[model samples]
Target: MNWDRLQEKLSILSDAAKYDVSCSSSGSKRTNKGGLGNASFSGICHTYTPDGRCVSLLKILLTNHCIYDCLYCVSRKSNAEVKRTAFSVGEVVSLTMNFYRRNYIEGLFLSSGVMKSPDYTMERLTKIAKKLREEERFHGYIHLKTIPGASPELIHEAGLYADRLSVNIELPTQKGLELLAPDKNHKEMVKPMDEIKQGIVQYKDDKKNKLVKSMKFAPAGQSSQMIIGATQESDLDIVKTATALYKKFDLKRVYYSGYVPVLSDEKLPALNTSVPLVRENRLYQTDWLMRFYEFEPYEIVNADFPNLDLEIDPKLAWALRNREHFPVDVNTADYHMILRIPGIGVRGAKKIIVARRYGRLTYEKLRKLGIAMNRAKYFIHCGKYYVSNDYDSLQLRNLILHSGKSKYTKQFDGQLSLF
Candidate 1:
C-alpha cells in the first residue's frame, strides 16, 4: 500500500468527518466471538460511558468528493478550496484493522459524500463493513451514515452488518433544505429512516417469535442528526420536527449540530456570525427532558414561547413560566410532579420518594441527598416549612440568578481575599 497517499486521505477524510456528531457506538452488544474487537453496550465515542470510562472510535469519511452543491456543506461540489479525496473499500478495511490492533480506536464510524450517486457511495460503505465483519472477523462496532437516495436493498444489507445506521436530515425544515440544499428533501431522508426503523422492528419480532436464531440488523438501532442555525427555522419548529421523527422512527438518538458557518453563501449565515452553541445545548437539554423527564414538546416550547430560554434550562424555564405549579410539596407530590421541580433530577426525585417513606424530607435532608438546594428551595417545600417567599416569577428569576452568582463570588473571595 502507498503509505504517503493513504496518510493524506486520512488527514482529509478524518477532518471532513468531524462535522457529523451522530456517530455514537452505544446500544451495541456485538461480542468478540474469536474476532478482532468487541462492542460493549456501554461504549460510546468521545463521550463518557455509564461506568465513567471514555472510549474512542475511528471516525472518518469514505470520501469528500460530491455531486451536489449544498450551500451549507463544506464538501459541496462547488467548493474548490477543500482538498478532495476518496478511500477504497480495502483501504478502509485495512485502516480499521490497523487502528484496532494498535488500540487507537474501539470501533469505526464511517460516513461519506455522494461519490457519483447515493447507491454508488453506499455500496462502497457496505462493502467496507462487510469485509471487516466477514473476511476479517472484526466484531467491533460500525456506524454507517446511510445515504438518503440509496436503494432500500442496499440499506437493508448495510444494516445486517452495521451496528448502528444514521441518516442525516441535514436541515431542520423543508424550507431550509430548499434554500440551502436544493437537491435534498425530507421525503428522501425519511424513506431510509422508515426502512431502518422497520428493519429493527422486524428483527425484534422475528427473534421474539423464534423465527430467526442468529440475525442482527443494526442491533444498536438507528439515529439521525439535524443542523441548527443554518436557516430561519425557530426552536419550536426544530423541536416539533425532532419529536415527530422520534415518534415515527423510534430513533435511538437525534443529534443536534450547531451550524459552524464554514462556507460562504448567499443563503447561509455569515461567516463571522457566532455559532449557536448555546441554542444547540439548550435543544439537547430539551430533548433529554422529553425523552427522560417525560416532558412533552408543547410543554417545553409552544406558540406562547417558540424558542428556549438561553439563560436557564428548559425545566426551570417551564417552572418559572407556570408559577402556579411551583412550591411543590416534596413529601406529598407524585413522582412526575417532583421531577418537574427545578434542580431536582430523576435520581433525586427517586431518592425523595424513597426517603419520604421513612420520614418527612426536610430542606437540609434534601440538600444532603445531593439536590441543588439553591435552585430547588424556591420551587419545593417541606411540611410546615416553606422555603420560598411569595415572590413573582420575574423576582424569583432574578433572585435565583443572584444567589448563584453570590455563591460563586463567595468561593472566589475565600480563595483570594487579602484581609
Candidate 2:
C-alpha cells in the first residue's frame, strides 16, 4: 500500500468510527513487557499532558463500505456522498503496530461496515487481532467489534485475541430498527452477543482446569452501544433495554451515543435536529445508579416518568421523588440508606459507615467524608443539626435546586439552560 493512500484511508476510517462511544480503553491489563505497547486497566482516551501532546486510542474502521443502508448511518450503502475504503488485514495490523511504535496511540479499536457478509467481515476483524498477537507480538489493547449475525465459531475466535468485544444494539426499540435498519434483526444481532457471553463463561470455567489456565479470552468482557434520541423511545425505554442487556449478557458497559444527524432522509431525524447529549449523560448516570448504587431501572424512570428530568440528575431526582425516605439519621443509617442520600456516593457512604463506628458523626465529619452537605443537609439529621421539619416535597425540591449554585449545579445549568 502507498504510504499517502494509507494515511488517507486512516483519516476517512478514523473519522467514520467516531460515532462509536464504546472505544474507551480499560478493564484489560495487557502489559507490554518486551512487546510494542501496553493497555492500562484504567482507561484513558485522547488525553493530554501539561505539555499538550496527544495520547489517544487509534479508533478506526477496517472498512466503511456497507451492504445495509441504515438510514441513521453516514456510511450506509445507499449513501454515495461519503468516501468509502477498506483496509486489508495486513494493512491494519501494520498500521496498529507502526502507530503503537510511534507512541501515537495506546491501543486499537477496530470496527467495520459489513464487507461481503457477516462472516467475511468478521474474518478480517479476527485476522487483524490474531496476526497482531502472533506475528507482531503486540500486547496493546485491542477492542474488536463483533459483527452482528456472525457465526459462533468466528466470535469465539475473536474472543481469543481481542481484549474487549462489542456488539452494537444500534437503536433502542425493535420498531425503530425495523423502520430504519430493515436489513438487521434484533434477535440475529444478539446471537453473536450470546455466543460471546457463553465463550467468556466457558473461558472462566476452563481457567480452573490447569491445562487451559494460561489462556485468556475477551478478558475485558463485552459491551454494546445504543444510539439515543434518533428514535422516539424515552429514557425509560433505553434504561430498560440496557438493564436487560446487562442482566442477560453480563456486559461490562452499555454505551449511549446521542444521535448525530449525518444525512437527510425521510425515515430519519432532520439534519437540524439537536443531538441529545444531556439526555445521554443522564442515561449514563442512571446506568451507574443501577450498576453501582443499587437503584432499580424502574426507580430511575418508568411508565409515569418515561424521560429523565433534564434539569436534575437521576439520583437527585430519585431522592426528590421519594422524599419520605429522606430525613435519614446520618449517624445511624446503614450504608445502603446512606447511599440513598442526595449528595452521598458509594465511597462516601462506606466512609460514613466506617467513621460512625469510631464516634457519632457531626456535620464536620460528614464534610470530611466528602459528602455534599448542601444537598444532604435537607435530608439528613446529625448531631442535633436536623433540617427544618416544615418544608414539603415541592418546597424541598426547590430548595435543593436554588439553595446552592455550586460548580456542579452551575455546570448542570450550563448543559440544560438552553432548553
Candidate 3:
C-alpha cells in the first residue's frame, strides 16, 4: 500500500529485468545536462524494435511472482532468495503517467510472470493495459507480452489497447521446452502467435474497418525471443526456428539472449557463464539474412555445420565459402545481389537501385552513395575495377575477420559509411 514500497519493488523487479534480450536500448548515446531526457549507451536502453520503426519504450514487468520455475529466470517462483512483488493496475498506470509526464520514457513495455494462473494473470495484465488506455488516456507506445493459450477473446481485446504484442518462443526446439519449461508446450506457444498474426492481418486487410483505427493491431507488429546455449541445440537449429517464426508469425524481430546461469536449477545446461557473445552475435546475423536478405536457414547452416563461426559474421562467412557469388558488378548487379555485399545495407541497395537508374554506377559513385568501399571491394566489381582476382579465399576470409574489429568502432567514428 505504501508508494515508497512500490518504488522499491519496481527497482528490484526492473533491475532483475536487465538480462532480458528484447529490451536493449538503441546504441545511440546522449548526454543529458539540460534536455528533457538523456539515454545511456547500455543498461536499460530504449530500442526501436526492428526496421525503421521510430518508437522507443520503457520496458518493465508487471510482477516477479512467477508460478513456473524456468531455470534461467530470476523471478521463477522457486527463487526464494530474490525479491518478489506485483504492481496493482493503478500502480502501473500511475508510474507510467509520472514517467511520461517527466519525459523519462516514451511508453510502457509490460511483461509478467505466470502469476496465480494464466487466465488470472492475463486478466491482471489486461486490467493494467485497459487502465492505461481508458482511465489514464496514456497514448504513448505500449507493448504487452501476450500470454500463450489465453482465450481468443482476451487476445482479440489486447490488440485494441497495445501498440505491439509478443509471445516469446523461449527455446528453439520442443525438446528444449520439455526439459526446461516443463509446463509449457510448443503448440501452446504457436497457437497465440498464429492468432495474433491473424488478428492483425484481419484488422488491416478488412475493408469494414475503414473509418475505425479498427485498433491498429500491434501497429509495430509482434516479436519473440530465443535463449541461446540453453540446450545442446545447434546454431542451425536455433536459426531454423527463428526463420520459421518470422515467416509464419510475420515477427518484427526475433531476439536471441545468451544463456546465463541465474537459478542453478537441475534442468538447465550448466553453461557456467552464458554462451560467448560471439555466438549470440552470429545468430543475430543469420536472423538478419532470414528477415531482410531473403536467405534460407539451410543456406547458412546445414548438416555439415550446425553452428556459426566465432571469428566471422554469417554473411561474410557464407560469402567466403561461395566466392562464385562474389565479385558481383555493383554497376550491373540486381538489388538483391548488391545487398549480399559485406558493407552495403538496405539503404545502399536502394541507392544502387536509384543511382543506376540515372546512369551506370562506378566505384567513385559507390563512395558518394555512402558505401563502405573496404568491405564492398572484395564482393563488388564496378566498371573496370575489381579486387584481386587471384585473392586466396582463406586469406580473404582472414582479412574479413580481422576487419570486423574495426566495423563497430568505425561505425561510431564515421570512418565506415552506411545507408
Candidate 4:
C-alpha cells in the first residue's frame, strides 16, 4: 500500500539498528594473514512475550538520519552517501503491537537517531513506550535506547515504562569517545547511566508506591553495549572497563558487540576482514566468569596471557595455566572454591553443596549431579581421591579438552566455558 512509508521505515530502522552494540555479532578481526579461516561470536537478538518466554524482537531503529556525526557510526553526518530513515513514533508503536498480536515478534527494541536533540528524540521514544504500556496493555519486552545526554527527568520517566533502558557507552574510554563520536562525550553517557542507576535503586526501595507512576524502574536493570574493534581498545581494556562499570553502576549486563565497518570512515578500522568473533566470544566468557563464576577481571586476563586463547576458553585456559590448584576434593570444597573447578556451574555447584549435606559425594554422584566431569576431572577430586597423579600443564590441558564425556558436552556450552 504505502511503499514510500515502508521504504522510509526500513532505511531509518536499519540505520538506527547499526548503533546497537548488544548482539555479540563477531566478524571484526581477521586472521593475521596466516591464521584460522574465520571466528566470530554470534548471539540472537531476543524478544519476549507477556507470558515471559523469550522470542525474537523486530530489533530495528526509528531512523538512522542522525544529526550527530559520531565517527564510528554509519549514520554520522559526514556519511551522507548512505540512505537514512526515521519511522513515525506512532508507526513504530503500531508495528510492534501488530507484530506481537500476529505472533511475529515477542517484543520491540526501538532505538533512534538523535534527530533534533537528545530531548526531542528521547521524548518521541518515551511516547512510543508509554503508548505501548498504557494504551495497548502490551506486556512484551521493551528495550529503549536512552540518549546519552537526555535530561534526568526524561531518563527517569523512561525507566518507568521501558522493560530495560540502555545508553550505549559507545566506546570504552573518554579518549575513544573523543576520537570516534565527537558530539558524544564520555560524561554525557555516564551521567545518564548514573541517573538511571539511582532511579532504579529508588524504585526498588519504594516498590509499594504504585500511584507514584513508578514500578521498579527498569526491573530487568540497565544494560549497555560497547563496540569492540571500532578502536584499538584491547580485550583486557574492554573487560577492565566493564569491571569498573559493573562495580560503579550496578549494571545488569555489559554487552560487547563486535565492530563492523558498515560506514567507510577514515577514522574507523577496516571492514570485511573477519571481525574478532573468537575474541569477542572469549570476552563474553570472561564477563560471565566475573559476574557469575566468582572470578575477577585481573585473575583471568593478565599480562602473560593478555588476550584470551582462540582454541580454548578462558576458564579451561586458566585451569591449564594454573595446574597447581586442580583436583579439588568435591565433597569438602566450599561453594566459592567449587565454582573455580571447570565443570561445576553455580547451579551445579549449589547442587553439590546441597547434596553433600546428606553424605560425601562420590565421582558417581557427581556424574548424576550433572557436574562438568570432563572439565571438572582436571580440577576436582572426590572422596579424598585425587584424579590426577601429577599436574603436567600441557598434558592436562589436552586431556581436559578431550575429556568431555557426552553428558558433560551436552551440559557445557563452549561460549560459557570461561565462566
In terms of lDDT, the poorest run of 10 residues in model 1 is: 410-419
lDDT digits (tens) for residues 69-160 of candidate 1: 88878899999899999999999999989988988888899999999999999999999999999999999889999999999999999999
Tell me the whole-model lDDT of each prediction, alpha carbons only.
0.86, 0.83, 0.74, 0.72
TM-scores, one per candidate:
0.93, 0.92, 0.85, 0.82
TM-score of 2: 0.92
In the order shown, the candidates' Cα RMSDs to the true structure are 5.2, 5.9, 7.3, 10.5
Error of 3 at 131 (Å): 1.0
Ranking 2 against 4 by TM-score, winner: 2
The residue-level lDDT of candidate 3 at 3 comes to 79
Q: On residues 320-394, what C-alpha lDDT tens digit does candidate 2 reach at each position?
A: 788778679888887788888888888889899889999999778888788888777777878755654555667
Worst lDDT run of 10 residues, candidate 3, spans 405-414
Off by over 4 Å in 3: 23-56, 207-213, 266-269, 403-419
Q: How many residue pairs clash in all the candidates, one count each?
A: 0, 0, 2, 13
Model 1 off-target regions past 4 Å? 46-55, 266-272, 404-419
Q: Per-residue lDDT of 234-338 in model 3, one digit per residue for the tens?
A: 988898888788889988789988887776654443755677877887888888887788777887999887889888888887788788886898777888888
The C-alpha local distance difference test score for the whole of candidate 3 amounts to 0.74
45, model 4: CA deviation in Å?
7.2
